[model samples]
Target: MQSLLEQLFAGITTKSAEETERIARAFAMLVPVDTTLAFHGDLGAGKTTFIRGLARAWDIVEPVTSPTFNLYTLYEGSRQLVHLDAYRLDSGADLDSLMIDDFIRSPWCMAIEWPERIADSLPEETWHLYLGINDQQTHTIRLRL
Candidate 1:
């Protein structure tokens, strides 16, 4: 699918941390159960927070954090959800090091963070979620298809 970045809603969350998770869970309703989401945002911009909400909404019981430590994390929720942090990837070669191509082709839906780090490896049909932060306290998530 084409990369789409459109403002669906605009609001301010004074308590960004807690509020962001609620927004993330709500996002779960926007796409198909088997759909993949590639999250694009800056550091501490609420990417993980949103994923936490996603997991919560999907009935993921375990904790969800930035998989930068593990490269990727999988949750066996009502639906399988794959979370990938591509920050360390510099090229397709690096992405291949993780052997994620097969996983991408699997039945699970994958959510990737820092997609800019692996720009070349993304499929033409991947969905992108662009996030913007202002004043280091406010964040905005835009859903792009």
Candidate 2:
């Protein structure tokens, strides 16, 4: 059988939020701590749902929600999980002003939504994932490594 990452790279279609979260949970097992994930998707594409799975993998008990209005939210579990939303930002400098790095602890993973808004602020090694809604209303997620 192919690795979860391999299957994700090939693209996976999720028919529901649970399926999307399951895929993300599997993908989280393959990711290293202190990683950065850039999520690209239109509204209602399941980006936050996927991150909720990641949080679950980390044993986070708190509810996971998009940080759209707050810009970022940090959750503590076995490791730190930082959720960032860059939809309102016009440039990377705006991201820099948030002082996000100061809040990050070691062994952390940062998942960013609307990452295109802060492309220049992201590390070169950031893993990119694209989620899209198909005509059938299912969501497809693909990794771009």
Candidate achieving the largest TM-score? 2
- How large an RMSD does model 2 have? 1.4
On the 0 to 100 scale, the lDDT of residue 136 in model 1 is: 68
C-alpha RMSD in Å of predicted model 1 compared with the true structure = 4.4
TM-score of 2: 0.93
Q: For candidate 2, write residues 1-145 as lDDT tens digits.
A: 9888888899998898999998888888888888999999998899999999999998998989888578788999887999998887665455568787787888999999999988887888899999999955599999997
**lDDT at 112 for candidate 2?**
93
TM-score of 1: 0.79
Tens digit per residue, CA lDDT, model 1, 61-82:
8989998578789887766788
Best by lDDT: 2
lDDT at 28, model 2: 88
Q: Please count the clashing residue pairs in each candidate, in the order shown.
A: 2, 0
User: What C-alpha lDDT, on a 0 to 100 scale, does residue 65 get in candidate 1?
Assistant: 91
